[model samples]
Target: YVVEELDVQNSIYEVPLELARQELDVKTLDLLRLDRRTLDLADYLAWLDGVLHPTRECTIAVVGKYIKHQDAYKSIYEALNHAGIANNAKIRFLKVEAEELEKGDPARILKEADGILVPGGFGGRGVPGKVRAVEYARTRKIPFLGICLGMQCAVIEFARNVLGWQDANSTEFDPDTAHAVIDLMAGQRGVTEKGGTMRLGSYPCRFRPGSRSAELYGVSETGERHRHRYEFNPAFRARLAEAGLAATGTSPDDRLVEVVELEADHPYFIGCQFHPEFKSRPRKAHPLFNGLVAAALQHRQGR
Candidate 1:
């Protein structure tokens, strides 16, 4: 359409119809067309307009180890784009290497970000950096969103800093740590094979009545997809809750922690065990990503 100057920018369906009439000499193209009212393209055009020309802008620093690979976090990047479109803001991604954060000062490396996001990853290679990034987001009052391993990092950071447990860590990194805020799922303790053994697929999650997560989702119950084996250790849940990291969302039976958030005065700080980005769409952004983008814009304005 852009090349041919066809009046099909409104609806993608128009492109083929126009091509048939203009080039292929299809006389019945108009008759074959569906009712215009049934195929309204207004909403699609509006969404495209927002994408082509966003009114606002904010930088979200994505702290992760896979910064070198473009497609490593493709879904996450697209989810952020969808969220930016919904908010009428252009997302400026500040891709910070997790290792770099460990080597340099986090505040200086992340000073330009209006929000900080720690994405999922495995192993202990850049975990300390991820934890440091979470700490930066927490203490500096920046809008933050953590997913999977990122969420684990948040819990570890809170346990060590706020809960005053210097040795707080995930057993995945330090099995001998005195405080294992994040640990392997009970069922996976004796598993020999690692392949195809993760807690995969959709699972029901119930949100706390007055939590920020529930407010953003506007629903008490929903299904989020999971792809990890390690989870928030239930053994430490009570102590963590006492120190103010509330597990706002959990499994249907309330046994597994699905979401955690700071209940205090921070504008927006939440971490989810599942990858909400997997469900985000261009026209219908996922609630969590939308919330993060909205909060990021607010933080930018405040600054």
Candidate 2:
């Protein structure tokens, strides 16, 4: 298996995915465009109106490793744009180095970001910076999102600080830890090797009652695509909830943790194991993302 490392501060680590032994094997994150799948103009226009704001705009920073490969995250960035069409908010993708925030003030580089997004990545090298990013968002009440590795970092930050899981961490990075916050599925096949081992494509999520996700999707259950190997270890979930972390959504089998949202008291903050950006379309923006952009606009509006 192969592992791709991306960093965020407050913690640093690596993910060792089991990919094929082939030397030429490389797993690069993809960028899919939303127009390819958007079938309705009315839907698109309606969606656009909600996010666009020209006279007044909100600056959103997508902090990640592949910020250079804009095409790879086309759907995500486009969805942001589609949302911005209504609010006239100019969405900007920033190639932020996770290491820079490791011991520095995140506000220095991230201060202007009305919304902060930490996309997926592999390995331990950038985990700490990510945790620090989450902390910065939480403390300052900035709209924050964690996708895949990003999701794991949020959990780790809460586990170690609020829950006091001093040893809390993903075994994929540190197997010797006593409190393994995340781990590989025992019966997990297809992904026994890195490329094919992770559960990919679309899957459904059963949301808890009265959830913003449920409200956004207009239902209690929703489907989304995923690309990851390690999953949230349920053993430590109780601890996370105790620390005010809410497991807002879960998978079909209830074995894997798929979505997490901060308590209602906080501003818009949510993380998911799956990439909602993958399935989003220009006309039909995913609710999670729409909510995120909306929250950012509201932040600037002082509403």
Candidate 3:
């Protein structure tokens, strides 16, 4: 009214209260049930609340570069929730910025973390921090899950600290590094275009017979979503395997490394090139997430 009185030009209109109320009423009816079922909104909401707000809680630190914008890892966060609900525990996600871990010991920052997850991302902005977190989890025997670039960090950390490769790094980070432990995938080579060029969508991975990943997944062959151009360099596969980083899963032809895991003694340290979080559901959590949550519960109990 004041703007109108001042003779101000504006392209805005107020919605009628009756019209808004009618729209709300229609939406409410539409959302009352999932399908033509007897279950109502109230009952569903109550059940959902109970599942989400559990008595037991476990803290899982998600160490990543994009800590400020969580939507980058939205699927991963939800996967944790699904796994938490499955185990009757509430997931308390701690967003640990990668830049902070580079400065000093992550112990001070991740002291209370029952589990540590290094999810997918690109670039070298916080790579050092992530590598430190991987080392912490490895030596401390804390439950850990590394996805995509997280897996690359684990390999790089192992190469530098365990295998004594001082100058080891991903080609994606340092194209002229002495050792390009992680480099561009064969299919993605010589591609100048960045958009939609990644090895995206579902791909199959075959698990080794008695590997921890096989046990966790309860299957030899399975598929998961991927969005990456870089892959574990095949040239260094022998050295990585000799250093005790078991190549648990691989591509159909066994040329590409899909999953890497530590020995049985490390509790639950597993990393995958694919994104298991993409397929995770509220009722049925991804096996990797489920295992991580379960291990976290045990870690908390021990601590």
CA lDDT, every model vs. true structure: 0.89, 0.74, 0.85
Model 1 over residues 198-303: C-alpha lDDT tens digits? 8999999999999999999999999999998789999999898988899999999999999999987898999999999999988899999999999999999999
Please give each candidate's TM-score.
0.89, 0.78, 0.83
Q: By lDDT, highest first, what's the ranking?
A: 1, 3, 2
TM-score of 3: 0.83
Between prediction 2 and prediction 3, the one with superior TM-score is 3
The pairs that clash in candidate 3 are none
lDDT per residue as tens, model 2, 67-103: 5565755666777776666445666655566777787
Provide the lowest-lDDT 10-residue window in model 1.
1-10
Return the top candidate by lDDT: 1
Clashes of each: 0, 43, 0
User: What local lDDT score does residue 222 receive in model 1, on the 0 to 100 scale?
Assistant: 98
Ranking by TM-score: 1, 3, 2
